[model samples]
Target chain A: MIQFYDLAGARDDQRLSPYCWRTRLALEHKGLSYDAIAWRFTEKDLIAFTGQGACPVIVDNGKAVHDSWAIMEYLEATYPAHPFFDSPQAKAHALFIKHWTEQVLHVGLTKQVVLDVHDMLADRDKPHFRSTREQRLGMTLEAFSADRDAVLPAFRAALSPLRTTLQKIPFVSGERPSYADYIVFGGFQWARVSSERDVLEPSDPIYAWRESMLGLFGGLPAKTPARGAILAK
Target chain B: MIQFYDLAGARDDQRLSPYCWRTRLALEHKGLSYDAIAWRFTEKDLIAFTGQGACPVIVDNGKAVHDSWAIMEYLEATYPAHPFFDSPQAKAHALFIKHWTEQVLHVGLTKQVVLDVHDMLADRDKPHFRSTREQRLGMTLEAFSADRDAVLPAFRAALSPLRTTLQKIPFVSGERPSYADYIVFGGFQWARVSSERDVLEPSDPIYAWRESMLGLFGGLPAKTPARGAILAK
Candidate 1:
């Protein structure tokens, strides 16, 4: 059996992390039986126990797999009958979209989230967000905010190519929801769920596509773990 | 015919990128025929022609595939018999290793090369490295160095888990060079080849593993791009 480690009940919340959701979706796509283990961000030991300090670690038949992209690859390789990717070209294109989604799109959305929605996020989630910012940027909230502010234009500019590419395809890979769509959807959904609805509205087809994805997953569940529950032992 | 966009020949020793080498290695592993097109970094307009701005992109049967990891996936999917990864477990492990190799290891080694080896690098390569730093970090040399200095400890710490994991397994997946080994060998080899002989040291099995890989490839060729050339443009 495949066991998935994530934040408990948080899988339903579109705002937490789409990367985690991608893995969940793939498991569902394969119709694989699995157990879900929820992790708390404040509880660093849970992550370390898995050998990597991150959520969404999948333990399958005793082997531990971290990183959503890696997990998806594992699933695809393990279950070849269903065929997650059809052709070599499609596989490559899917990967390209996945990388861009993680590296570029996530970066842009993170910037928007940290700078634009800081005040609106729940006080409980603020520390987790701030810690992530510090880890990625190696600075305190004040410094990160200043740095994020300075790069806003460049971040927006960097997004043009992705927007262009995404505009051409309904899903990142065109028709079906390949691994690429799962990854991008996870991150974008996180941003949307964590913050404002309008954050994604102006983006057009991407916004529409995201809605479709959420619907496919039976409408992002609102049963996220309580802040206290997440923090408590 | 498969046409690979690459910087073939050693007109400038610094023209090589580890990411490109991974693709080349995969072609060799699969024993595929391809045309290697020599491309200049500045004249990357050809890559831009494919709606992307990165090299080591392969045009397989006129279809463009970008991103080294994605390219490998394309190869594996297209040519399943040769098998870069055999099982889903293996594939997941390969991708897990690939992610670490590409994201963490490459980032570390590139930092060392750009900051410490500037004088030794070819003239054409200097501007490219500096420009990458500027674009990625939005900082000049002094600031970049200071930032890297602050981050090196964390970088090394990040590598410790990987190092421990590699020590336990001969290859990332044990015995065979999966996609992980190909991706990792490229960047790790770059650091080894460009740095001083003892820079990696016998204490680190990573060094021995790297040398083993080099032996597997049978030494860097003396001339420009002929012996190891797997594809043509």
Candidate 2:
């Protein structure tokens, strides 16, 4: 069994890190199971043995694998029978999707949800999270996202590529979902779990794709507890 | 032999439409011979047989295939020997790349070089081109691109996904250049052929990839005549 050190917010069930979601999806893709040990930002000491502060680290049979991309590659290489990468070209394209999601989508999404995520952190972890995030953002959480509504048009416009692609196919990887789909879904799942604000339009093809993604692997992502969820709050 | 209706500017040698470039590259990738016809912007009547006003309309053995993507699919299906799309997943991912290039990259890139492209137009076609483009842009070309230098940083910043992807691999399709590479190279090639200004910094990884792309097919793109070329003018 793999021992996955997953990142969690204030509530143990508030698993909001996009990287962790990617790993979890990868594990499920490979039909692997692991104990998702709920870990927080300040609990860096818990994963210090891995020689890294960040996580989605999976200690598989005592071999710890960190970094979402590494973990994805590790799973694909280790479980060759469950081939996620069909070809070198396919893997290379998937790598583009990964970077696009992280470097582009995550950059824009962070601005919209950093404050919401900070608020969801454990009370003790707030100060550490706030100081680091605020400094990195160069403003208070509220101020950073204050203009999100104004910037919404630009943000949606930036999604032209993803929107255009979804308009053609049901998923990034075509008829069926693949690791490439999971790679992109990570950012959206993180945003979904962390914020109530909708990033996608209900009528969008992407929205339909997200519904299909949420329904994947027996509703794994959909089942996760949405942070600051208003359904019953 | 394929009869590719290539978009040209003032000089017949000045081929600058990105979509046409994609088709030309695709023809080369398939090891097909083509007579690239220089079709100016005002010469829409020349391609009326295809029922479209687009260059890149390939008349392959009397069958006119309009649109770059439709041409790509036609070539792939017709000449199955040179298989760039190994699977449906591969094709789907490539489609995403195409959309990304069209929607995001082209939008930003046009702002950078639309005026230059206008400058490169045939004297007879200039009026028609300017009226259509200015209306589409909602401003005169000069006014539209007046602040291009000031917006350079943001334009460069918008290339986050492409930059991040190239930093990881030599090409968008990994070890070898594929249709996906050509899809992206199209926009840059258009800019290169139309403008003297370099869109990429020499130090950027994308600049290195562009060099690799330029080196492909015996320096086909690199050897093209840069329009209104001031370096030697």
Candidate 3:
């Protein structure tokens, strides 16, 4: 069994890290059973063996792999069945999706739910999360959260590509749930787990797609305790 | 040989329509020969058989297909050689890239070179182009072109995913130039053929990738006349 280091929040099961959610979903997609250990943002020393402070570090048969994308790559290479990428070109294109998710979707979504995420953090993790995110965002968490309502339209507008894509296909990776689906879904899952503020209108195709994703893997992700879910848990 | 209806400017060789460019490139990628007919904005009656006024319409063996995306689909279904998409999933994923290029890249690039594009059009195209565009843009061509310098940064910033992808891979479609590359390169090629203003710094990986794209198929696209090229034609 793989030992997955999952980022936890106020509750041990409150695993709200988007990157960690990607890895967890990838594991489930591969049908790989794992023991998810609840880790906190400030627990850098616990994952020191991987030389990174991230919660997505996975230990499979004593081989440590950190970084969500790297872990997906590792899993695909190791398992070789139920492949995440259909072809080399698919894998390459997936990199663009990954970058778009990281730079565009994640960046847009963070402003929407960062304060809510901060509130969900454990006492020991709050200070570290605040300091790091505040420095990176170049504004206080409250200040970043303040303009979210005003900026919501722009954020939703930026999702034009994703919305258009979903209108054409059922999953981001096409007919089946694959790595690409997991990559984008991670951000939505994070927002869902951390905030009650509905990022998506129920009428949206994306809202429906997210519902189907939540129903996947025998409702594995839906079983997790969410902070304030807008949709049925 | 297929008959391709390509949008032409003042000079017949000045083929600057980004959507049309995608079909042309797809034709080239599939090793198909095409007799490109010069098309103007006001020439709606010319392609009335297709029931649409798009320049990207391709009349293949007496079959008419309109829209750049639909044309590519028709080409793929007809040719089936040198596949544009690796699998159904790749094709599905390409839709997202198509939307991104259309909504994000093309929209940003248009404001930068709309006036220049107007200058490149034939006398008959000017009125229709201006009237339709000005109405859609809610401003005159001159007004839209005014903030090009100020909006250049945001335009460049939106290319973050493409820039990051090109930095890692030689082409947008993994190791080989596929439909995804053509979909995006069409936007750059549109800018190149219409305006002298350099959208990319020479240091940028996208500039290098564009050079490679131009050099493809025995320099077929490079043979076309450009307005005021910053790079060697």
The DockQ figures for the candidates are 0.04, 0.74, 0.78
- Provide the lDDT at A184 for model 1: 67
Q: Between which residue pairs do clashes occur in model 3? A: none
Per-prediction TM-score to the true structure, in the order listed:
0.48, 0.97, 0.97
The C-alpha lDDT values of all candidates are 0.61, 0.86, 0.89
Q: Pick the winner on DockQ between candidates 1 and 2.
A: 2
Q: Which stretches of candidate 1 lie above 4 Å from their native place?
A: A1-233, B7-15, B116-125, B146-154, B193-199, B219-233
lDDT of 3 at A9: 88
Report fnat for all candidates as fractions from 0 to 1: 0.00, 0.70, 0.67
Question: Which candidate wins on lDDT?
Answer: 3
Question: In candidate 2 chain B, where is summed lDDT lowest over 10 consecutive residues?
Answer: B224-233
Question: lDDT of candidate 1?
Answer: 0.61
Model 2 residue A69 lDDT score: 89
What is the CAPRI rating of model 3's predicted complex?
Answer: medium
Ranking by lDDT: 3, 2, 1
Cα lDDT tens digits, model 3, B1-233, are 89999999988989999999898989888988889999998889999999877789888889999999888888888888898998877887788888899999999999888898998899988999999999999989998889899989889989999999999999988989999999999999999899988799899899999999988889977877667852355
Give the per-residue lDDT of model 1 (tens digit) for B42-65.
567788867877788998887789
lDDT of 1 at A81: 66
CA lDDT for candidate 2? 0.86
Clashing pairs in 2: A10-A121, A10-A122
